[model samples]
Target chain A: MIFDTTAIAAMDKLQRVQFATTLPGPKPLCLVGTRSLAGRSNLAPFSSVTHLGSNPILIGMVTRPDTVERHTLRNILETQSWTLNHVTEEFVAQAHQCSARYPEETSEFEATGLTEHHHPSITAPFVLESPIRFALKLEEIIDITSNNTKLVVGRVCFVEIPDESYSPDGTVDISRSLASTALDTYFSIQEVSRLPYAKPAPPTP
Target chain B: MIFDTTAIAAMDKLQRVQFATTLPGPKPLCLVGTRSLAGRSNLAPFSSVTHLGSNPILIGMVTRPDTVERHTLRNILETQSWTLNHVTEEFVAQAHQCSARYPEETSEFEATGLTEHHHPSITAPFVLESPIRFALKLEEIIDITSNNTKLVVGRVCFVEIPDESYSPDGTVDISRSLASTALDTYFSIQEVSRLPYAKPAPPTP
Candidate 1:
């Protein structure tokens, strides 16, 4: 049977979906800022982080398209750099505390009772409590026409990975990281398995 | 905290994971011709499915760099139109079966025990069992870089959305259809939520 435009259009519409991840992780991120219009510090939990490309090592996350009060967005736009810290299973409670809406001067780390660590190469501050952390610089920002979000693409600059979580190929095993998801609900990544890699190709003709 | 490239790169390499998906969902696709080609099909998946312009109902997908025997590539190239099928939970079984190494003359649809619905608008065959499908014409094919996989942009000739899956905005809810990752791993969409939308800005300030 052959398919025409009619059938093609039908399925395309059905595949559209919306994504909103607001859940906090186990560890809180102390988004340390050296320069901000409002000054001092801010901490927030974001789960939209994703890698877009490898050649340039591009990482992206969706942010408020028209955020009137996105201090993080202001910081990224101002300093053009931001550090991403993963909240492990142990820091879930502390990570949640940093998410509180607070005055710019009120340090979320102090307010949430979490400690902060300075990145060795970059000027941004990181959460010493986070088992995994990475620093990045803003590369490009693409506003998708289909969604009300800004796809913030950045370049990775520096990183700190717990020794226990490291692999030979440089992949992080998620089993022990204590990662969580904000899929309209909270979930943890406990047991992960690797399967045969069906390398991209059709069976030889 | 601000992120630099080094740190960001480290995290991606560290967290790199392998996916296990043989389910019926999006796979590699392309447009090949029946001219001198021994088979009447192409193989590959479209990762860049997007609305080029709603007025004309143009849809596009990027067929990044490939170096293999892909039926989707030749079929679209030989013929102007190709059928885009959505890999569904039900049909992914047969779809994956179609991906097996078979003779060029071997009709994947027939071997996999799946039904292909013919499209009248074009001469392509769509997967009837798929929750979503589309028939499109080759509007353009651009290689992002020399010697890289080409980005096959198609002008949606037609579409099909399941009756129960259609939403109020003419979009269908995909959670019912299930989403898969194209990376080495394929993850079933675990959840879905709503967000108003984000505003946009270009690459340049």
Candidate 2:
């Protein structure tokens, strides 16, 4: 079926959400770790993470205006420090539990029983169960005026990956990474093939 | 292994690209279609598409400073309209071929042999081979000053999905949708399980 703007607006609230969120297809699932000024740590699952650049190693993620995820946005804006831990099948359930609307005083690390680890100087926590992770410092927050959502941009200050996953060419083989299609549906990725960089073929007749 | 910012900066250029791009994990794959005001059409593969909101149905994508993708950015800027077509395993080879630096006058549709279909009143072309697609209108472009990239945001004006893949709850079971890690690696997703809406458990005693 096809849905135009008017038809989409007429969709049931929850239905529109499921449809719109998954329309972009599977997203990169990561557990964002942040710390409040009071020293309380926060962990939230986000699938909006996108690679913004490589030279400065920038990443961007979106946060809804009216969700507990705002806590993460607020913490990042205030502390300017956070961590992105890639969720794998082994701990996806625990990572998904971090989405629960726990009170501000609650640390998802404790609430969800996931071990929180810390790098040398960064204050934000990292998931011990996550095989690939990054320590990041906030750079900018772009507001999506149409919807009150914000795109949080960060510069990678530190990086971590398992030796096995890290390749000599610098590609991290995260085939074991778990992905989400919608809010509730989860999937595991299997690398089918890796193609060479494309070079345009001679003009077709 | 771990690398600090300084260490990351010292790495080889191509290695850095692979490392930083895949740092966020697998990304949603889509063929972004746009039409220049001059009447030339363009198609390019993008892995940056991310859901920014649902109510107004916003999606965000990132574009590098120097690449053929700039054609996509320029067309959207000039025409204010575009289409995002999800890539599936069947046509991934053709979709990946879109990344080839075809001349602005060449439509990837013809070069790659993928059929392009248009919706009435919308000039942007949609991939007829794609199972899920969206007609989008340019909303805003936020410049990533840190690295000179731009975050292109668009509002969904229309949506089309396969009847069999779309569920009653509005979820699109794009388990067949292809995902990419780094630059060349592609993966297929398998829906493992769908969890219920998470709610915070009663405060532990």
Best by DockQ: 2
Best by lDDT: 2
**lDDT of each structure?**
0.47, 0.89
As a TM-score, model 1 comes out at 0.53
lDDT of 1 by residue, A28-67 (tens): 1223333365555566766445444454555555565443
The DockQ scores of all candidates, in the order shown, are 0.12, 0.82
Model 2: per-residue lDDT, tens digit, A1-205? 8889998899899998999888988888999999988899999999989988888888888898789898998899789999999988888888889999999998999998999998878989999999988999998888777677888889999988888888888888798888886788788988888999998897549
Which candidate number would show the highest TM-score if scored against the true structure?
2
- Clash pairs, candidate 2, are none
In model 2, which regions exceed 4 Å deviation?
Answer: A203-205
- Candidate 1, DockQ score (0 to 1): 0.12
